[model samples]
Target: MTNILHITASIRGDESVSTGLGTALVEKLAAQSDAQVAKRDLDAETLPFVTAERFAANSAAAADRTPEQADLAAIADTLIAELQAAETLVISTPVYNFGPPASLKAWADLVARVGTTFKYTDTGPVGLLEGKKAYITAASGGTPVGSDMDFMSSWLRFFLGFLGIADVEVIAADGIMGADGEAKIKAAHQEVAKIAA
Candidate 1:
């Protein structure tokens, strides 16, 4: 069965428009493909930000790490393993200060390990997670997706590319707090249905 890793980063919980839209799309995909989904709610299950100790642990050999470093390494290993096992990734995020949430960034920091998710080469950094598809559900209050003021989409796209997930699609629910917010959301729902189908 197809394994889908769904990561939600909305601190708003049940009231988050992005979470609602993304979850609906994932449900549709699951029903159509019989995919098994593993969810990681960043708001609910808060992940510790990457620290200097964690960095040191990542730099050392697996067998040579200190006790604290080993603990940090194991957490990173588990997160990386989840990504390695999944065929598709569904990221639900809301734009905060024109960027992604801090929790999502922390997750990225943890999973992005040297010689694990990526590696250095003579040319440049090479990403290891290849042949995986990713879908992003981004919600914003005023800033629109792909606009000059919006850093969320481009940042995410670049980060995902850095990890070798080149086949990425973004389904944005933008301008959600604007005058035509309801219409925008309705249109986004229609688009989500089309994409999910």
Candidate 2:
């Protein structure tokens, strides 16, 4: 069976435009292909930031990890496994202070383990999670998408590409605090409908 991973980082919950867009896309995908969705709610689930001890535990050889290290690395193990298992990923993020939320960053810090998600080659680092399709449902109140001031989508797109997920699509409801905020959100949803088949 096909698996779709839905990752949400909006603290606004149901009021979040990004999360709404992602949910609509996921529902359409699940209906079209009978896919099962696995969700990681970053807002509700607080992920720990990477620490020196946690990084050591995560990078250690699985067999060599002590019991204490094992406990520390468990969340990362699960996060990586989720990324590995999903063929499609829908990430919902509302721009926070010009970038992704802290929860999302924490999640990224955990999942991006060397020799697990990606590995270093002689030339450069290579991503392992290639050939997967990803969508970024980004919502910003004032920042314009893809502009110089908008680091949210830019950073996310680059990071996903670094993980070998180059085939990505971005749906944006940017500058939603502007006069045409509702119209922009509606247009973004319409865009989702067009591509969700």
Candidate 3:
């Protein structure tokens, strides 16, 4: 069976536009394929920021590591394994302060480890993970598409592509703070439909 990893980074729970779009996309994807979905809710009970000790532990060799270091390494290993095992990944994020949420960035730091998700090669930095498709649903209260203020989507695309996920699709729910917010939302949904189709 195809394994799908669905990650939601919105703290607004049911009121999140990104979450709603992500859910709809997953539902559509499920109906189109025999996929099993696993969810990680970063906003709800988010993982702690990686500590200095944790970082030190993660870089240590297994056979030369202390118990604390070993435990932290194990957590990192599990997260990498989850990402590797998934055939597809869906990330729902709301732009915060002109960027991705802190929790999501933390999650990225934990999983994008060298020798696991990516590696440095003679050519350049190469992503170890391959054959996986990714969908990014980004919601923003400012900085509509085609505007100078837009930053989140391009940054996310670069990050994901840097990790070797070339087949990345994005749905931007922009202009969400003004009086035409409802119309913008409808347009976003229409964009999602186009992508889904």
Which of the two, 2 or 3, has more TM-score? 2
lDDT of 2 by residue, 16-81 (tens): 999999999999999999999999999899999999999999999889999999999999999999
Give the distance in Å from residue 124's predicted Cα in candidate 3 to where it truly belongs. 1.8
Compute the lDDT of residue 7 as modeled in candidate 3. Answer: 89
TM-score of every model versus the real structure = 0.96, 0.98, 0.91
Per-residue lDDT of model 1, residues 1-197, tens digit only:
89999899999998888888889988998898899999889888788887787878866778898888888788777878889999989999999999999999988888888888889999999999999999998899998898989998899999999998999998988988988998988888899999987
Better of 1 and 2 by lDDT: 2
Better of 2 and 3 by lDDT: 2
The residue ranges of model 2 lying beyond 4 angstroms of the native Cα positions read none
**Candidate 1 clashing pairs?**
none
Which residue pairs of candidate 2 clash?
A: none
- As a whole number from 0 to 100, the lDDT of residue 113 in candidate 3 is 77
Ranking by TM-score: 2, 1, 3
